[model samples]
Target: MEIGLNHYLVLSTLLFAIGLIGVMRRKNLLLLFFATEILLNSVNIAFAAISHYYGDLTGQLFVFFVIAIAASEVAVGLGLLIVWHKRHGNIDLDHMSTMRG
Candidate 1:
């Protein structure tokens, strides 16, 4: 059977769901960042598949921008995680409650 747009969308939905669950259940800063990345990647896959199906470049272009944003997010988020880990000795989300400004 030929793969179609529906297949890609289903996969994307599954990845997004997994990411959402990870975000909700994970307490470690690093793990949370990974979950967020999964979410971004899922959207990128959907965008690419739709672009290909419609014979348009816009969705593909958006995917490129999303990738760029995800890369920046990873850089900033990992930097923050590293610093937080060093300062607190752990990257638990619960521990961040004391960081209120």
Candidate 2:
């Protein structure tokens, strides 16, 4: 009747799986970024759960760093998405190759 590490792990695994599927199936650049964020959040959950289970702060610390990085990634990624959308008038992944150098 109580939550445990296994519960967190299962949830994390499910989230990661969903994110992976989204990344694979989504053709929009914004959707891909969303999937990546989901994947990052799943990892954060696992790290925090394991850290709590082991009575250690390292996992929690790592989670903080991950959050910071994820935030910055969202900023840069959204900026790029906006630029791409402006230039192309669309955000399809299939047409991204047109930006190649």
Candidate 3:
């Protein structure tokens, strides 16, 4: 079977939708972070497909930058998660409220 741009787009759409649902429904910050990663991966798939179709390197270059950013985001986000866990002893996002302050 020959995969085309449309196929790639459809797959990415499904992935994004699943990620959105997870992000909206999950109470755990770790799960929410995983969903965000899925969303980023979907974007990368679309960009790579477009770059391949256009025979241009720009999209691939953008993908590389995106990967770098995602790596940094995950690292920083995990660090924050650790700190929050240390203070709160939990990672449930719903358990947080500034009114507690």
Error of 2 at 46 (Å): 0.5
Task: State the lDDT of candidate 1 residue by residue for 16-58, as single tens digits.
Answer: 9999999999998888989999999999999999999999999
- lDDT (C-alpha, whole model) for all candidates: 0.92, 0.94, 0.92
Instruction: Itemize residue pairs with steric clashes in candidate 2.
Output: none
Candidate 1 accuracy as lDDT: 0.92
Which of the predicted structures, 1 or 2, would earn the higher lDDT when compared with the native?
Answer: 2
User: In model 2, which runs have C-alpha deviations exceeding 4 angstroms?
Assistant: 99-101
| Candidate 3 TM-score, C-alpha based | 0.93
Query: Could you give candidate 2's per-residue lDDT for residues 1-101 as a string of tens digits?
Result: 99999999999999999999999999998889999999999999999999999999999999999999999999998998888788879999888776572
TM-score of every model?
0.92, 0.92, 0.93
Q: Candidate 3: where is the Cα deviation over 4 Å?
A: 99-101
At residue 84, what lDDT does model 1 achieve? 78
